[model samples]
Target: MNSLLITSTEESTGKTAIALALATLASAQGASVGYMKPKGTRLQSNVGKILDEDPMLARDLLDSTDDLAEMEPVIYSPTFIENAIRGQEDPDALRDRVAENFAHLATDRDLMVVEGGGSYTTGGIIGLTDADVANVLDSKVLLVATYREPGDVDDVLAAAESFGDRLGGVLFNAVKDADYDRVSTDVVPFLESRGIPVYGVLPRKRELAGLTVSALAKELGAQLVTPNVPTDGYIERFVVGAMGAEAALSQFRRTKAAAMITGGDRTDIQTAALEAPGITCLLLTGGFQPPGAVVGKAAERGVPILLMQTDTMTTIERAEDVIRSGRTRDEETVASMRELLAAHADVDAILQ
Candidate 1:
């Protein structure tokens, strides 16, 4: 059976989303696809059973019946690092365990898609890093990297150096619009010349990065002030209305869909956000409720008002953390991801 390991240069590079998309695409082509996350981070509790979120998402999306625990061989527990440092955890045994799980999961499968931990070198302390585990599983690496600046190409090259011949290709993800041209023009050629194929270049998609208003409100513990507002819509960016009302309006107008976060006391900024065409919702800080007129206007415009006790800085940070934490639990996101890949990515080459 063929094995493709999806890993990243660092955390939150969208490895799970790309892996699920490519796997879904391959499965559509009539191949038996198996999934695994050798070292499960981003722990969660499902049905009173503790497991990683990525594997659970993959399992549900791929419709695999394999046991979750078996699919994710290693769960990063509270004291996992402490135990590893104290020499209580055996490296060779853990390696064997992961390999054994891969073998079992690979049964009668045409391809196995393994997701590594946070980054390529995530498990270096325990000898379970992506390179280490790939060596044991004999899998080729599909490196998903984010290029905020051109210098990031060096980061990809550095990671590729470690994988050497086993590097299947690189997928430049979440690339900014400004940097996409250089990545497609100069960077792709350099990498391909070095024997590493460039499978895809996906610009940052707000839909893929966005969190629903309802989900954001729930996660932030904010109170919904407006009645019967649509909270199911997604908000891509959360802009802090720290500047003057005029400046804030200009910024808010730029985003196609975003939540304007400001102090509840900043009535000017609040009013401006309400008038802006792109403001999907308003996150008011300091637990202060908006005036009846503001509330009426928000309700009239169908914008949700989420009130929270946390200050502006804290709320902005929390919202960012939520956006950075990607998701594939919803069908809309799944469908859009496939569309993005089909248009921009070489799904056939990568899976082939």
Candidate 2:
């Protein structure tokens, strides 16, 4: 069976998001697509609740429940590489386990999209780094490098130079709107001249950023209070509370949003928000347990309250963190992803 691995040069660069985008494009072309996240981390709080595992996200977006292990078996932790190197664990066993999972996924699927953990330069002690998985699966690598500053292009080129033939192409993500023309005109030529295909230069559009509210809650290693929150349409804008109750309430009041995000423990803020007019959705951050009163009020008002365990600061940080990384429907770069899937024509071909 053939599989393609999507990876990045660093964390939070939208690896899983890009994988899903590719799946969206492939499914459009009639490919029976399968997805896998070889290393699952940042697990959910509830027992047996798997979260931030790339395979699960891939399967959910693809609308299928393939076996979790087969889709991805070797989950990674901070000490994974350390333990493996000390001979406390077996890398080959982990490899075999994931391979078995892959075999199952490959049986019924025409194309399987495998996502990597962290940057391509990353490797855990248990023997599953981006390179290890790439070598084992014999899959071509599509590197996602986010452009945050002037030297970002050099990093991508260096990664390509480092990986050499294993590198299939690179996609420049999270690019500023002003630099789009410059990147396409100036940067694209240099990269192409060096024989590295600038697959596409994606503008720093918010909509194309990865994971909506519900998805963020899942990834934050928190409990999911509202499973199916509306994330498909346009999110008007986001407002975060930095000061205490007065500041939060005042800021929240200014927003006429489809959704409002705040700390779960901020009862004063929550109470005010519950009583306030014109908010359809409430996102409680830092996993704060909502007061009974707030919960009851929200229910009566028919407002959806998402209780995520990430702390107020961390939650807001995470939200704002990925805001620039979110995906949208209006960008030309998205069109490029669609185009690549169409050009490939076969999942098996890319996998091979």
**After aligning candidate 2 to the native by TM-score, how far in Å is the CA of 228 from where it should be?**
22
- Per-model RMSD to reference: 3.0, 7.1
lDDT of each: 0.86, 0.66
lDDT of model 2 at position 211: 39
Which stretches of model 2 miss by more than 4 angstroms?
49-53, 79-82, 210-352
Clashes of each: 0, 20
Candidate 1 residue runs with Cα over 4 Å from true position: 77-79, 82-88, 218-221, 241-257, 262-269, 272-279, 300-302, 309-317
Angstrom error of the Cα, residue 128, model 2: value is 2.5
- How well does each candidate superpose onto the true structure, as a TM-score? 0.86, 0.63
Which numbered prediction scores highest in TM-score against the true structure? 1
